[model samples]
Target chain A: MNSQPPAASTETSYGEAIRAGFVHLLSSHREVFAIGQGLWSPWYVGNSMTDLDKLFGKARVIDTPVSELACTGAAVGAALCGYRPIVIHPRMDFMVLAADQIINQAAKWHHMLGGQAIAPVTIRAIINRGGEQGAQHSQALHAWFAHIPGLRVVMPSSVADARDLLVASVLCDDPVLYIDDRWLYERKAVLPAVSERPLAAEGPRVVRSGTDITLVGAGYSSWLCEQAAEILAAEGLDAEVIDVRVLNPFDPAVILASVSRTGRLCVVDGGWRNAGWAGEVIASVAEALDPRQLKSSPRRITLPNAPAPTSRMLEADYYIDAGHVAAAARTMLAARETAS
Target chain B: MSHRHWQSELAGLADPAQYTAPLVIEAAQGTRLMGLLRSMLVIRHTEDQIGQLVVAGLARTPCHLGIGQEAVAVGVATQLRTTDRVFGNHRSHAHFLALGGTPTSLIAEVLGKASGTSRGMGGSMHLFGREFGFHGSVPIVGATIPIATGAALAAKLDGGDSVAVAFFGDGATEEGVFHESMNLAAVHDLPVLFVCENNLFSSHLDIELRQPSDRISRYAEAHRVRSLTVDGNDLLAVEAAANALITGIRQGAGPALLEAVTYRFRGHVGPNEDIDVGVHRRMADVSAWKRRCPIKRLSEGLLAAGIVSGDELAALEREVVAKITDAVTLARRADYPDPSALHDLVYACRP
Candidate 1:
């Protein structure tokens, strides 16, 4: 197993890395255009698209009106006509308005045209959770988009993955849905001078490795798993942290190998538990590995099947955090002891 | 036919008779006019064949026939170059045929044959022909409208006068995407021509029941897009309106909406008139609109001007029938897609 440390040369926030990545792509490629409702506005788009209009001019960095469906459809059309268009949906909730274009036109165009036509449109949908944003605005609709056939769904957890994945998705020739959680925008991590990860990559990555139990997550949950691994380390439990970055072209080889060695698995997901992405992971691992691999049944840590509550207390209880992940890992370890 | 019943049905819209004026071929480009007439006849005969196939239960797909709406497509296509992008809604036989997509490929697609335009993948509602600049058509109400707008944006960015045309129904105007697309095109000054074939019925429901007024071009006006409303069945009128709008779009004057007030001779789905579906579609209005048939009106003008004799028109009809017959036979003989080929084209992996 070639489990080496991430090549970190400097430290940076996730938001900074994403912003820098876009800036670099826009500078290098003349065909790429950053367009959305509040791309130029500081308050609406945070530091991700900050000063992009000033740097690349308004034509390349367009600030569109509050028209998600048309704008997103326009982006798809532009991509079909040989322009690499990056559309920011700012919130996943609003992206639902443009689902027809994204799912029907962008995703199916290549196949519908018998591979003669392709839409290289990257939709950066931000998962803005918590803080009384209410049910409508606060949603992680990664599983919904992942259910689609011809879409490349990716959730980057760390600053490095965020930077590299964004660049890869922009350059990829297929329709890519790059999901990023707003909560992790401030999270800081060491930055590699060059991409330490795979360039034309697909599948999960082992952020932290161990022998006992495996904690699998994607996007926000992946970061939580990393923190949970730290807490588990203090508790003398060696839990492996695997971030399933690309969910659509998801290769289960790395995950299956990790599970076969570790013998215990705890899948963490930001979305609801029932029929969620985490369930797919757990199901695949269970179907692959032998029962005599000799450990406890895999557990899935996810939100209950309910709309996002507005109250801060309910919000806190509703979401799955690092502590929750740590507790799930400990429960799996305890089950292992009982089985032994 | 009860004129009172028809009048009540078409109460708000302008007089349908005024728009359906008998075409005049006097000094009109005789060869081009004759070509347009032949194209209309081909569409009419092709649709008639489809209607028969649908009744025979040979065609299992849902076919939205544009029987009486031939002039709108023929007229618009007259102004379009092979390089300009054109998109269509569920009913798009004329749009494809007018753009020179082979009748055999279209019939093959409907029959789910490998020789189909979409390679038997997308049956009737979904059509694809990019070589003729007829970019794929979707069944979704307002789906391809914005796509055409984006294509126009791309054309502008590519530094050319290439125009993007979206052919949709008046029913699609109810979709927010239509309004958004119009606004986006207007805001960007993109070279897009929004063509709304207002057949006045959204499936089974009448436009009277759907909107306050039958004039859908008002929505185009709301978006600040220059629009022209004409008798869609009148080939000359539609051709003139489309020519002006397309010319402006090519000159970079921005997006324009051409509302062609036309009617479908058949049902929303399948071949029948669809009045049996308990909907409020007036039989009298159907009869009245029949007199304003685009093909009949254009032929009448051609005949009056002696541009095309009755014998020539008969020969043209025979030729079209033979052509469609041959296409149907070829489509029937074509193979179904290979079973192992099912996994292909889901994602276009970059080579």
Candidate 2:
């Protein structure tokens, strides 16, 4: 497993990395354009696409009206016309209004056309939660999209990947759902120079390696796993951290391999517990490995299967944090040692 | 004008006598008129054969036939090039055939043959012929309207005179995306034409029950898109209106809507006349609408103008029938796609 240690050089925030990605795409490729609601406003999209309409022309970075369905469908249409368009939905909750276009039209176009055409459109859906946003505003529905057949679901947990994956998704000739969390935007890391690579070359990556327990997560959950690994390391309980970069087309090779050595698994998912991505990861590991190989039963930490509450106190208990993940890993280790 | 004014005009056109008269074909328009007539004939006969296939239980897919509404597609497609993007809805056989899509490929598609337009992947509702400028058609109502609008945005950005055309029905106007697409195209000044083939019924329900008014152009007007409502069964009217709107679009006049008021001879699905569905669609209404058939009207007008003799008209009919018969035979004999290749096109291979 290769670890991506931050270099001692210039640092970039996850939000700024996304901005730099847009800069690279717009400056290098003329066929690429960004369109959606509040693209020109910083308050809605944070510092990710700051003043892109000015750097590029307003025509290229279009700020459309509050018409999610039309804007998404239009981006798909432009993609069909051989342009790589990124349609941003500031809040992932309202993106459900445009699900028909994303699911039925864009995702099915390439296959429906018998591979004669492709809608190389990237849908940048931001997961906005916390601060008492209520149920309507808080959602990370990546699992629903990941279940789709044709769509490529990508969630970048690292700062470098936040930028590079956005670049790769746009350049890719398939409809990709690029999910970025606002909580990860503040993350900073010293990065290498931008190197364009195919999204197919990316999958589950091990960020931190240890043989005690296998910790798996995606998006914000992946970041929590990193923090949990640090906490576990200080207590002499070594944990291996695996960030699921690409959810769909998910390869269980890395996670399965890690579980084989550690003989223990714990997955953290930001989505709901029922039919969540955490279950999928655990299922993959359980389906492959023999029960005798596993010293303890696998475990998954996820949000409760209920709507998000508005009060901050309720939210503190509702959402799973790094502490929750660390505790879950400790419990698994303790249980396995006791069983032995 | 007031909203009532447009509704009154639509009501006037809906009168059966308004479309019974022969079209006025001039000497200079003989060739173009003949081409339009031939194309409409091809669509009608081709759909008639598809109905036969449905009756014979050969075609398993849901087929939406636009038998009487051929003038809308034939008229609009005649003025478009292979580069101009075109989109359609569930009832899109006319749109496909009018844009030079072969009867063999279309029938092969309906039959789920390897030689089909969608390579046997997409059936009747999901047809694609990008080479002929028919981008695709989906069963989802009002799905492709915004797609066509976006294609227009690309056409505008490409700095080309090419435009995009979206062919939908009056029922599609009820979809929120339809109005949203119009607004987007208008705000961006996109080069797109919204062609609404208003047969006045969404499935078994009449438009009067669905909306405050049966006229769909009012929605276009609400979006400030310049629109024209014409007798869709009249070939000359549809052609002229489509030509004018397309010309304006090419000249950077934003988007335009052409609402062609026409009817379907067959049911919403399959081969029956649907007169006995026990809905508002009575046999009397169907019989009257058939009398105002677009193909019959155009053929009579051409004959009256001395563009073609009686024998020539008969020969054209025979020729179209024989051609479609041969195409259907070939399509029926073609092989179905191998089951192993089903997953090949789910994702595009990286270049």
Choose the strongest candidate by TM-score.
2
* Candidate 2: residue pairs that collide: none
Give the lowest summed-lDDT range of ten residues in model 1 chain B.
B1-10
- In the order shown, the candidates' DockQ scores are 0.62, 0.69
lDDT value, residue B186 of candidate 1: 97
List candidate 2 segments past 4 Å from native. A1-8, B1-9, B275-280
Tens-place lDDT per residue, model 1, B107-180, is 88888877899888777888888888998898999999999988998898899799999999989999989999
What is the C-alpha lDDT profile of model 2 across A60-82, one tens digit per residue? Answer: 99999899999999999999999
Scanning candidate 1 chain A in windows of ten residues, the lowest lDDT window is A1-10
> Candidate 1 on A94-155: residue-level lDDT in tens?
99999999898899987766667889999999999998998998899888889988899999
Which candidate achieves the best DockQ against the true structure? 2
